[model samples]
Target: MQRLLDGIVKFRRDDFENHRDLFKSLKSEQKPHTLFITCSDSRVDPNLITKTLPGELFIIRNIANLVPPYRETPEYVSTTSAIEYAVLSLGVENIIVCGHSHCGGCAACLGPAERLNNMPHTKRWMELAIPVRDRILKEIAKDDIEARRWMMEQANVVEQLKHLMGYPYIYEKTISGQLMLSGWYYIIETGEVFIYDKNLGEFRLANG
Candidate 1:
């Protein structure tokens, strides 16, 4: 807690002072260009990775960075609502669903049932990745942990992109080229990001 407080103090004294004008300009409204959705992992810093400034990337962080198919319901819908607001209200041009290497959520999705049985809510949330788990298991050997993990992580990103298209507005915008959707697989240790290439039918290094 003290560390967090000290960081805040340092930010106010240094970073904040340096970016004072930029922060002041954003006091009223924000117009972000992209909707960046990724895992709520401590190591994955969206802004740091993308080199985006404040008010540039509207972000949504979740357990597995999952996006449930669009549905109208009275129940609380945090992720769905954020997606709607980012696209409809904020008019974000791009939507990036980023899944990383060595994701605990992805591992949990591929792990034994006992791994998540204790957390009912998380277990239920992870149900969205069940198809991913099933598909990867058939494609890779059970003993090949690394291969399975890579497939599971990248497959989950692709799955969420499908879910995003289920939203009527998102689908329309995407098809009409008004909105661009991308699925990215980030390798943590190597600092490499592979983007899904629809034409190639696989993820390729962002530059390569």
Candidate 2:
């Protein structure tokens, strides 16, 4: 906590002061270009990874970077609400669903149910990814744990992208060519990012 507090002070005295004009401009309103949705992993920093400034990317971080299928209900839907606001209200031009290597949420989905028995809410939340999990299990070999994990992580990103299309506003914008959707797989060990190619049906390095 002290470390974070000290960093805050330093940011106020240095980074904030240096970028005062930009920060001042953002004080009144913000017009971010993208809605970056990614995992809640501590190591995955959306702003740091993308090198984006404040008010540049409206971010939504959640377990496994999962996007639940769009549904209409009286229930409070945090993630769905954010998506609506970003697309309809903020007019973000793009939505990036990024999933990273070694995601605990993905692992939990792949592992035995008892592993998450203690975490009821987490277990329930992961139920959203069961379709992805089921597909991977049926198609991928279970002998290689590493291969399964990697594939599951990448597939989860694609799955979320599909779920994003379930939202009416997102679908409308995408069909009209006003909004673009991207799926990204970030390898933590290599610091490499792979973008999903819908045409190729695979993930390829961004530079490649």
Candidate 3:
């Protein structure tokens, strides 16, 4: 906590003071160009990874970075609402669903259900990745832990992109070429980013 407080003070004295004009411009309204969705992992910093400034990328962070399919339910829908606002109100042109290597949420989704039984909300939220888990289990060897984790992590990004398209407005915008959808896998240790190529049906190094 003290560390965070000290960082805030440093930010005010240094970073904020250096970018006072930029911050001042953001006071009234923001017009971000992209909606970046990713895991709520401390290691995965969306702004840092993308090298985006404040008010540049509207972001949504969640467990596993899952996107539930569009559905009308009488339930609290924070992620869905953020998606709607980013696309419709903010007019973000791109939506990037990024999943990372060695993600705890992804591991939990692929792990034994009983392990997450105590974490009911987390368990339920993980259910969103069941389809990806099932596909991986059917084809990948149970003993291949590394292969399974990597495959599931990439597959989950594609799965979330599908869910993002399930939103009516998002679908319309995408088809009309008003919005673009991208799936990215970030390798935590290597600092490498792989982008999903729809035609290749695989993630290729972003630089490639």
Candidate 4:
């Protein structure tokens, strides 16, 4: 708590002050170019990783960085709404669904059946992992927990990207070339980022 407060003080005194003009313009309005979605993992800092400024990347972070397929349910879901707005309203050109190494949520998804029994809501939510689970089971089934876990993490990103496209507005935008979607995997320890390259059939290092 103290560290965060001190950091806030430093930002107020140094960082914000040094960029007063940028902040002043942001005060009036914001027009971000991309919508970055990633895990709510503490170590993953979207702004820091992307080296983007305050009003550059609109972001959404969740437990597994999951984006549910487009639906109009009785309940209100904030993440879906954010995606809709980011695409149709903000006209954000790029949407990046990022998964990461050593994700607890991914590990849990790949683990025992008992894991989900305790948290029914989580169990239900993670049904979205079904496609990912099946893909991993068929292609790269491994006894090593760590290896299987990370494979599921990467596969989950691809699954979520498809879910994002399931959104009608997102699909239309993508088809018309008004929007571009990307899947990224961030490795925490090495500070290496791999971007899903559709043509290469591999995760390639992001150059810029």
Candidate 5:
């Protein structure tokens, strides 16, 4: 808390001054290129990882970075509505569904023991992850726990991307080639990022 407080003071004194022009430009308008949907993990800073500027990436961080299947139940949730606006109104060209290694939410989908069922809302939030379980189970041979966990992390990203397509605006844009969807996994330990290749059905490192 003390460090964050001091950092804010320093930003006001020095850091904000360094990027004054950038902030000034952003004050007028914002035209971000992508809708970056990622997990609300303390260690995962999207801008820091991508080296993007203030007006570059329009981000949505949530528990597990989960995209719930498009629903028209007459009740509005901010997450779903935000996704609609980012696609239809903002005209974002790319949508990135990023998941990371060691995701607690993804792992919880595997069992009741790990999931804190007492936390009803948290469990409900993780219900978005249910589809990924079947994929991981099908892919992992020998019933290996370690193998299942790793595959589940990557599969969760792909599953969320699939759910993104359930949104009408996003689906139409993607079909017409006006929008592109990317599934990505970030390995925090190695500082490595892997983009899922739909063609090869595997994740590969971004090449230099």
Candidate 6:
């Protein structure tokens, strides 16, 4: 699109010029400290939210920000393999599973199956969040649309964090204090971020 092209030109002229030294250092190799996993939603910009620079966050994004529980398969698993590379190969210190409000993927998971009849691949991918859907159904009233949506988004983040622990390497690193795990819920419209607290067992405002 023309917009993307114009943005690229402007970036090369302004942003790239300003960060020339940073880009040159990253030309050879990158040593990012965090593995940021989130949705493919255009609104959820990991770098913008975290205020991280290039080579600071290794990002892996997909629908609903779901992480498939670790399993060996001859078939290529995109999300699983990326996590492996970030953790074992790149040695990222932290992994954050972020989910945002009003996510189409999360909404689809909570909706009727026929709604996704045409999107077979996406429907299959959403199976990873079935537990999240189930929990929302059980705990929240069907008439409370806002409650259901908010719960689905936050619970999905926690669910993916659980899936991340299924990775043996990630688990070992976490146990040894080499890696940290976090679940985040971002409010797109409000610019608010909530972090899951293990002690309180609920998401709390990150700023406060």
> Residue 22 in model 1: shift from native, Å?
0.7
- 17, model 2: CA deviation in Å? 0.9
What tens-digit string does per-residue lDDT give for candidate 6 at 1-208? 9999999999999999999999999999999999999999999999999898999999999999999999999998999999999999999999999999999998998999889999899989999888889989999999998899999999889888888888999999999999999999999999999999989889999975
- Tens-place lDDT per residue, model 2, 39-71, is 999999999889999999999999999998999
Tell me the lDDT of candidate 2.
0.94
Q: RMSD in Å for candidate 6, one decimal?
A: 0.9
Steric clashes per prediction: 0, 0, 0, 0, 0, 0
Tell me the TM-score of each prediction against the true structure.
0.97, 0.98, 0.98, 0.94, 0.93, 0.98
Question: lDDT score, residue 67, model 2?
Answer: 91
Candidate 2: 10-residue stretch with minimal lDDT: 139-148
* Pairs in clash, predicted candidate 6: none
Better-scoring candidate (lDDT), 2 or 5 = 2
> Candidate 1: lDDT of 153?
95
lDDT of each: 0.95, 0.94, 0.95, 0.89, 0.86, 0.94
Q: After TM-score superposition, what is the CA distance of residue 54 in candidate 2 from its true location, in Å?
A: 0.2
Residue 196 lDDT in model 2? 97
Q: Is candidate 3 or candidate 4 better by lDDT?
A: 3
Which window of ten consecutive residues has the lowest lDDT sum in model 1? 199-208
Better of 2 and 5 by TM-score: 2
Q: After superposition, how far is residue 112 of candidate 6 from its true place, in Å?
A: 0.7
| Candidate 3 structure quality by residue, lDDT tens digits, 1-208 | 9999999999999999999999999999999999999999999999989989999999999999999899988988999999989998999999999999999998988889999989999998999999999999998999999999999999999999989889999999999999999999999999999999999999999884
- Candidate 1's residue-wise lDDT over 1-208, tens digit each? 9999999999999999999999999999999999999999999999999998899999999998999988999999999999999999999999999999999999998999888988999999999899989999999999999999989999999999999999999999999999999999999999999999989889999884
Model 5 scores worst on lDDT over the 10 consecutive residues at: 108-117
